[model samples]
Target chain A: MTPPPALPPLLDLTGIAVFALSGALLAAKMRQTIVSVVFFALVTGVGGGSVRDLLIDAPVFWVRDPWVAPVILMIAFITWFTPSRWWEGKMLDWADAVGLAVYSVLGTAKALAYGVAPVPAILMGVITGCVGGIIRDVLAGRPSILMRPELYVTAAALSATMCALGTLAGLPLFTVWAIAAVAGFCLRGAALIWNIELPAYSRDP
Target chain B: MTPPPALPPLLDLTGIAVFALSGALLAAKMRQTIVSVVFFALVTGVGGGSVRDLLIDAPVFWVRDPWVAPVILMIAFITWFTPSRWWEGKMLDWADAVGLAVYSVLGTAKALAYGVAPVPAILMGVITGCVGGIIRDVLAGRPSILMRPELYVTAAALSATMCALGTLAGLPLFTVWAIAAVAGFCLRGAALIWNIELPAYSRDP
Candidate 1:
């Protein structure tokens, strides 16, 4: 078999940092203890991919690479020590959007690289992007975003589609990342700005 | 292959109801919506075994036997509509202990019957007994009982050992169940009454 194309370590690092920050912010909001916050960050940063690996009988990623855990912990510690009031504005929202965008593209790329069929690859992307946050919310005893009419999953789906299409068209890796990240960021940003949501069904008496 | 031993439907029904009740009680404490309450109950009651089956490549028990879902749902509905205070106090604790005891023995028995070694079987029993509650606590955003200094895991381990020993000694199934269940119940009850906790280590200066 031909060797698989290499991905930039910078791209992976960016995605991991963003995802870890998102998890830390959520844990901070929940007022979790320092240890719990760090645990949540680590789990949210890696939980989906871990589950995917386990299901596919692959060696778990973090077990092979110890760097992921320390990076997540560092992010968690920074978030925990930082005052909430310092982050209580558009900056927080923007950081979250960036994290979502990065994670979506990364998930799609990883799934494709794993040689999964297109459909399962796309599903895995969505699963990888959203499951970590869903788990975070579940652990916080909040309604999972999946049960809500948020633009989160829609943003992920769009980004994943872009990544898959770009890969199939033999686009450069950086180009694929740029396009997919822009799509996810724009979609999610617009949703937050306009309070956009999926239409709800009303139960009539 | 030798013919599989027959398992009575009544025992299955009883186990399902007991587990469902425990799940429902936890959901009520968490104040989840009706749909979430029912969903939690069903998942908690069947999830551990389903995970074990999936990992072991066994046909999922509920998939093969459809009756389990309905029984769980029925119990959930009953718990939902019942007076909130009805199952409170000592009764709820008793119910929880009973559910844990039954599930632990059932897990051990199932693992042994499937020809798993004694060590894995006992571990499976502890997992099956504790995982549902862990998932429940995680989703409810509470510190899992496993994370706390409690007699929870200890009780399950003891009961599982008894069941494994009983099977090795050629004791009757019901006798094993009785011995394991009573031991588990008493241990858990003691923990509850005494606020027993595991020792926590303090950081050195």
Candidate 2:
């Protein structure tokens, strides 16, 4: 069987770095120790994909390739070493948005490649992109994004749909990735800047 | 395939009730809505075994049988409607211990029957017994049992090992389950009553 086409290494590295940074920043906010920060970062970078692969009976991607963990660790180390002030402002949010987009598209593409049906593939993409951060937040003793009224899940779902549509339209993988990434990033960024949230209903007595 | 030997229906119902109660209690502690409590109870009753079945490419037990969810939902509804005082004090703790023991042995026995090797079988048993609660806690925004300073994982590990060993030594399934359940109940009971905890290390420079 022919090997899968090569993905651009730089984009992959960027995805890992951004995800690791997102986890590390959250760990810092929670005042977790450096060890915990590193652990969270690694989990955020790869945990969702691992769960997806395990469920689908695929060999775990990180187990087959070791590069993912090292990149996560390096990002975690850098975040921990940097002064908190450097990340205390707005840059961290931007990184998180970018990470969410990249991971969502990557997850969708991977699921499609694995021959999952479109619905499951879309769900897999959302799970992969969002579950890591949810796990990180949960472990850090914070409410998950799912529990919050935020547009986090919405962004992920929309981005994954874009990826699935692009694949169905037979777009090149790189173009699909770019389009999905932009969609996710813009949605998340808009949510952050505009303070957008899903509407909620109070209990009717 | 010939149907496996029948388990006593009463015992199965008792186990499901105990597990469902524990899940409901945890959901209450997490301040979830009634809907969330019921969902948690259903998943906690069957999630671990479902995961194991999926891993081994076996039909998911609940999907095949459908009785599991109804049993758990009944327990959850009863718990929800009952006065808080009825479930308060020491009774809740006892129920939790019983649930832990029953699930642990049941998981190990199922794994062994599925022809998993000894080590993976034992691991699967522990994971199956413990992972549902872990997932419940995680999703409920509580510290996972793994991070708790308690004897939770240790109890599950010991019980699972005993179950695996008993099966390997050709003990009858009922006998193995009984022995493993006793071990788990005692361990967890001791941990709760005596406040047993794993050793912790200070990250002092």
Candidate 3:
């Protein structure tokens, strides 16, 4: 199903907006047309959530809600009109980190509400936070998030795990969600500041 | 929802098996471990259908069926054990073309059954035939089907269009499906033999 409708709409929107912006930015960087920018935005904004909804047998979030498409279109328009260099900075990364953190927790919470098992629910969260970017990268034929050794997915997993654990421990929903999001954001931020990376695999056994 | 339950089981399975084999063969070619092979097999086999199901708001086929996972695992094992040279030829291409054709028709039929409009249903058919390989290529960091000028997606689109048109013309379901499948397969087969391709995009206005 969709993210809990009760969550404040602002936080719920952060992920899609940031994801959409990233997709639009990628399209712009490729010198593509407005059509491509909008298409990329729509796909990135909805892809992860759509995948989660399908897995959980819930109606896709965008289909029922009219606002989602319009929001993506607006984001795409802004991206198309703005100079691409305006997006070339650390601020964008920070925004994406915030989105990743909040979305991971939100996805986990929704999965828990739907009676999904804790592990899979946590996975649902990571998938929610990461899949949009992956799809965008694939469509653009760029090196994707998974190919990098960065802390992106790990941060999402951390948030998802924390959300699942906190809920299992009988924590209040708002507190658990806030803490989980912060925890993930902190990890991603630290990675950004320190250039942290996971070790690459080696074939020698 | 899942390709019309009334259809015979063998036809229903042809698409997934061929897709799974392609995924496994790719992994085997890459000299990946059995774990990676199985994962690839599962993802490629179900990826397209899962995407179609999600879009159409239908239950994912493999999630409900116990047989799907085991069959993928079996395919993975067979791929892993076989010598790589065994698959170095045109026969495999023919097999994949069959999968593409049948899956496109099945996907369109399922979407139409779910009350999706004709145009979107046809797109769904193409998506169901192509998304699995696209996802696989992305994960493997390889050149995807979309980058090529070949007639792969076109064949699928032709099948989907024919199926949609046939249904709209009051043709019997079985007749529409069979004819559409054969039409797509023949096109793809001809492409394989004669190297047919669509015109490349040009920058000139």
Candidate 4:
């Protein structure tokens, strides 16, 4: 079998870095030790991709790759020493949006390469983009994003579905990847800017 | 590579059923719908094993096994329709303790069969026994068992560590499995009956 198409390194590293930062930031917020911060960063950075690989019956990606843990550690260190205010702005959200988009698209492409069915492949992509955050939130004892009506998972779903469809239509992998990421990033950015939320279910008492 | 040893079907089924019941009961406590109960049951029943399979690079056991989902569903159905009072006693906890012991032994055995080192194999056992409860607790918005000082995870660790050492010492699988599980179960039972708790960490204010 042909090797799976390699994801763009820039996008992949950026996603990992941002995700590690998010986890470390949460640990910092909780006033945890440096060890906890590093632990959080490692899990958050690799959680989604690890789950994706597991479902596809592949050797876990991080175990084979040497760089992932170190990069996550570096990010955790940076977050640990930095001022909290530096990470508490709209900019961090924008970075996370980009990471979500890129990861979703990459996740879809990898699943398709492994011959997964389209719908499950799309779900894999969403899992790859969103599960790390969910793990982080759960570990921090916060409500998961799925509990909120915000557009986070929806943005991931959009990118994943788009990537799956584009691949099915025989689009070039790089082109489809870029387009899907841009689309997801736009939606997430809009949600951040507009404070958009899905309508909550209500019933007359 | 040699195939992993098969666990006793009765023990396996009991573990799955008890874990599903625990998940469904949590959903019921939260006043969730039947759908949520079923969802919770399936996840909690399979969650630990799924994580173990993933870490071991094994095909996810549930996807291939026909009986797992059906059994979980049956348990969920029983849980949903039963009066809360019917499940309000200590019986469920006892059942869960048995399941935890059996699962920890099985998980360690499987990991060793898959060529994992002993320490990590022991961890896989603990993960297989405990992660489902963690997921169930997180989804129900309750503090996870990990956050408590109970003997729960420690019981799993005991069973897993014993199983690993037994296998290394060339003990018969059946004998080792029984001994390890009984040890764990006895400890857990004592904790439950006596309300044993670990001392909380303290720091000077």
Say which candidate scores most in TM-score.
4
Docking class of 4: incorrect
Better of 3 and 4 by TM-score: 4
Task: Write one digit per residue (lDDT tens) for candidate 1, span A111-160.
Answer: 77777767777777777778877877776667887898978889888888
**Two-chain DockQ for each candidate model:** 0.06, 0.10, 0.11, 0.10
Model 4, position B55, has a per-residue lDDT of 81
Q: Candidate 3 lDDT, tens digit per residue, A132-199?
A: 88888878887888899999999999999999999999988899999999999999999999999999
* Tens-digit lDDT string for candidate 3 (B101-133): 988998888888887767667767887888887
Q: What is the C-alpha RMSD of each candidate to the true structure, in Å?
A: 8.8, 7.6, 6.9, 6.7
Where's the lowest-lDDT run of ten residues in candidate 2 chain B? B57-66
List TM-scores for all candidates, in order. Answer: 0.56, 0.61, 0.61, 0.62
* Candidate 4: residue A22 lDDT (0-100): 78
TM-score of chain B of each: 0.90, 0.90, 0.94, 0.95
Model 2 lDDT tens row, A91-200: 87788788788888888787777666565667567767877887787777677765566677778878898999988898887888898889988989999999987654
lDDT of 1 at A127: 73
TM-score of 1: 0.56
- Model 3, residue B19: distance off in Å is 1.7
Q: In DockQ, how does model 2 score against the reference complex?
A: 0.10
Docking class of 2: incorrect
Can you tell me which runs of candidate 3 are displaced by over 4 Å? A1-42, A52-57, A61-133, A143-205, B1-5
